[model samples]
Target: MAGRQGGHHIACTGLSAFPLTPMRDDAVDERAFAAQVARVAASGVDSIGALGSTGVYPYLSRAERARVARVTVEHADGVPVIVGVGSLRTSHVLEHVDDAVEAGAAAVLLPAMSYHPLTDDDVIGLVETVAAHSPAPVIVYDNPGTTHITFTQELYARVARVPGVVSIKIPGVPTEPAAAREHVATIRGAVSEDVTIGVSGDPFATAGLAAGCDAWYSVIAGTVPEVAVRLARPALAGNAAEADAENARLAPLWQLFTEMGGSIRVIAAIAELLGIAEQPCLPLPIRGLDGEQRRRVAAVLETLDHAAEPDRDE
Candidate 1:
């Protein structure tokens, strides 16, 4: 997996996180999305996550997801774009892997599949299946909070050995320093340090850096890519002071997302406030923010210097 076959060493090193693009009226706002990607890339993020949970992969039709993926890669310049290929059906996920390759993504990220409370073998099979089909590389995304299937240390080690399996996206849960250490050990033991370990959690990204994770995958990056980039740079460079200050500024926003439900709502709120798209077009049940919640999110966005425009009627 480490060869130089027209692919660079997968740079999962800095602020690389999944970003949700707010959709509108059964179509993604192409103009707005291009602008959003350009802004995120300019903010110093190391990677862009397309069709992730935030991107509402489950909600979009196959073609729509492909369009988003293609547009994302085109606008990302050289930044690595991790294509989300998490689908319940193995065939569908493989199809997405092909799409990622065609769209020129650097890697694929997939959540642990169907087997709720998946066994080691179950996790291994899923990882192996996706790894076999992915053109670039694949990262096993382990988020028990959403997928309801948890891959233990032994299971992770087994999957890590799969061909083309190059990274692990672990939730920075139980966010204590000790917990982060245990996770890093678990992931590192499963694969060589060559296989990156990406921590995902608002506080966990910062905590994981302290715990020695190679990279971080976070939702916080969607709202404030600059803050996320600043936070990651200091830690990656071994500068604790700057990292801590950056995290301090991000803490309130983290609190806001958690208190206001979680990543989905926070992403929707931010997209609305930024006016990047008309409405947060989450599939049924994941609707736009209510009046009070909108006010709260607006307050948070007001603190940032990023450009904001009035909502347009379409």
Candidate 2:
């Protein structure tokens, strides 16, 4: 947090777009994956988050993830790339971090991915070990929904003290503006000022940023970057009202996320409808939104397309 890590500040602030790792025929679709990286890079996002939860990091093999990190750096057009390195085992996580850094990743997103419950010491040890071994900076990822490990403020303070730790990606902020601001402030106070706090939970990206979180670690941005960027620009500019307006504009998109149960399927559905990926792009047994669900997703996309608005960039 004292800036000792010295990597790009994208880990701390700005919009880091998480692009999907598309699959086809039960294989990692390198072509589709490359295209996704290139598309996110083209959008002028602050950074490219490769192999994130949105990118299905835990679903792929180490070799596949290494290849993905390479593809992401190659297609990122010089945009910094943060690779996810989370696994059930510490040994595997270390291996993934090495592979990611060797593949030219700018930073590594480390989460305590566990099949068994993890103690605070276990998670802390994981962070310390990675920070010690990997040259790439570490972004602590706190995703209780998927990883089943919630981070306490005390944990944040402890991890932020690790030499190479640069960012902490927290879950959604409170819906109420005052509460959201307080939530972000408490975390900010826990860590050194150099450590950036990023907000995940796509629906609350705007509020998180507006409340003073420096970065938006976004999932939906992986599919529709322009919309996410539109919201971020204003929020980062300190124009909270404008950012909220933009978020309000994507009400249908957010509704779809809640209705479809989660972001992955809905995003995969959007990717297919946009022709960025083929149907069944997700890994096996996880068949993406199908038939009627897909139709509903399509209608949402169509509405978004029909009502598209211009951002300042335009």
* Residue ranges of candidate 2 with Cα displaced over 4 Å: 1-11, 305-314
Scanning candidate 1 in windows of ten residues, the lowest lDDT window is 1-10
**lDDT score, candidate 2, position 202:** 85
* Backbone atom clashes (below 3 Å) for every candidate: 0, 0
Q: How far is candidate 2 from the true structure (C-alpha RMSD, Å)?
A: 4.0
Candidate 1 stretches with Cα past 4 Å from truth are 1-9, 115-117, 305-314
TM-score result, candidate 1: 0.91
Q: What's the CA error at residue 310 for candidate 2, in Å?
A: 21
Model 2 Cα shift for residue 35 (angstroms): 1.2
In candidate 1 the C-alpha lDDT for residue 221 amounts to 72
lDDT of candidate model 1 versus the reference = 0.74
TM-score winner:
2
User: Candidate 1's error at 204, in angstroms?
Assistant: 1.5
The digit string of per-residue lDDT tens for model 1 on 190-232 reads: 6766677888876767778877888878676755676577678
